[model samples]
Target: MSAPATAAQPSTFSRFLAPVLLVAAMWVIQFVDAVLPLSFTGFGLRSWDLQGLLGIVLGPLLHANWAHLIANTGPLLVLGCLVAVEGAVRFWTVTAFAAVIGGLGTWLFNAPGTLTVGASVLVFGYFGYVVLRVFSPARLAHRLLYAAIALIVIVLYGGAMLGGVFDAAAGVSWQAHLFGAIGGGLAALGGRRRAVSA
Candidate 1:
């Protein structure tokens, strides 16, 4: 009898494939923007465009340019790993919640008539989730995680925030950051409550 066919090796596409494909798509969009200079506004979802709402949802998958995407890549990989560990269901739940809520917050409060684009809001939301999870009282593991996240934030955003107070180009929306952080905190708390009830 012919030897039993070994189960097909899992495709590389099965591992990190989703996120990789997503990042690749983002890169393509950015590249097209560079070559064609397509307006970043209303990429076919006008009424739903809802200003930077697209940024909150599709933002994580889009970038201002290669440099901007590159700057975000490391964090995206790290946070995506963490969420993946949390399992697909919870991972998607946290991400979707953060994006929707963070986007809504930005839409409600961003400078009038100004449309924002990019995944900075979702990125900030991931950062916030990491920060809150590390500090959440749900588990000892979370405490350690929180401490590490705090260190990262201090290392990354501490000086940037101070600079924003003085620099004009630092017109970064502190609001998006604030709401993203809030969404993360809320997600962590909700997760903790569910764990306790269970």
Candidate 2:
């Protein structure tokens, strides 16, 4: 008797639907922010304010304006797709870890009274993950990928750091960037072991 037909593997688009849906949901909420005077800041438990918990999950979706949201969407979309490709389980794991750690990093390291906002921390985390994934000793890729990541970091963050030094009001949270990168590094190390085992 013929063996039962195996189910076909889903297409790349199908695999990516989860992240895409999330991105769309974020976009919709951003639009809602434009029209509504809603702020979660005053609604939750006093001890656990907006910046404490909701900020970790919802902060990425809330933006200062269209330009800010646009600035973040591209990197988020690209890196998120790559993470999902690693497998749904790993994708969610990295995302949840990055968001929580990045938020806590902001809470702990940010200057007191400073109102931190935006998804840039998570963006940096995504970049960190990519770097670790490429540079891991067990990865099946050529050395060029690792070199490219190094070059990208130097060209991008290096310039941003130097610029931050001169422009005091640039308002970019280099601390969040730093902590998110560290968080991503830790997550990557854990993920690397899984890759090696696989």
Candidate 3:
């Protein structure tokens, strides 16, 4: 008998699509803001303002500055691609949870009128999902792969991730980091359930 055909790996284009769109959007918004002499940051998550509630949708798209967006781009691509390996559906589901949860947390906990912006919420959330996934009840092989990937992620970003949440410096919203992680955990568990059911 002929050998069974293996499933195809996710295409590079498929993996990169979402992240590229996200990064491109940030850059385009930044470009417009730079040329117009108006800061788009006010559109970010502003605490305690009824109108600021809109930020829950817009926050991740607006960055404080070029430097801020640049800083988040790399981690966003790396971790976002990891999630994308499962396809866009999973990637966006985790992203929605992260942004909504992270944004709400910041809105409730961060100082009123403070403008919180950056893709760090997504970055931290992706980190949480990637790391927590190792402990999920998937097939042994899948879990082992997750464990290896998690270990590598930990060694690279562990300290930074910890500092991001608990040891946040001034101007950083620890609430977003902490809650984004919470959201990521929720996604990981949700994903595991779906996987097992399938």
Best by TM-score: 3
Better of 1 and 3 by TM-score: 3
Arrange candidates by lDDT, descending: 3, 2, 1
Tens digit per residue, CA lDDT, model 1, 36-128:
856453441112345434455665565555776786676666665555455555556666766677667766776664454555555566666
Q: List the residue pairs that clash in candidate 1.
A: 59-119, 134-145, 134-146
Models ranked on TM-score: 3, 2, 1
lDDT of 1: 0.60
lDDT of 3 by residue, 41-73 (tens): 888888999999888888888888889889899
Candidate 1: worst-modelled 10 consecutive residues by lDDT: 40-49
Count of clashing residue pairs in every prediction: 3, 0, 0
Pick by lDDT: 1 or 2, better one: 2
**Candidate 2 residue-wise lDDT, 1-198, digit = tens:** 765555455567776776677678767867877778875323211112444556667665566667877877877777667667666666677776677787777666666555556666666676667667665665446447665765676476556534433452566666666666666667788876876688
Off by over 4 Å in 3: 1-10
What lDDT does each candidate get?
A: 0.60, 0.64, 0.87
For each of the candidates, the C-alpha root-mean-square deviation to the true structure, in angstroms, is 5.6, 4.1, 2.8
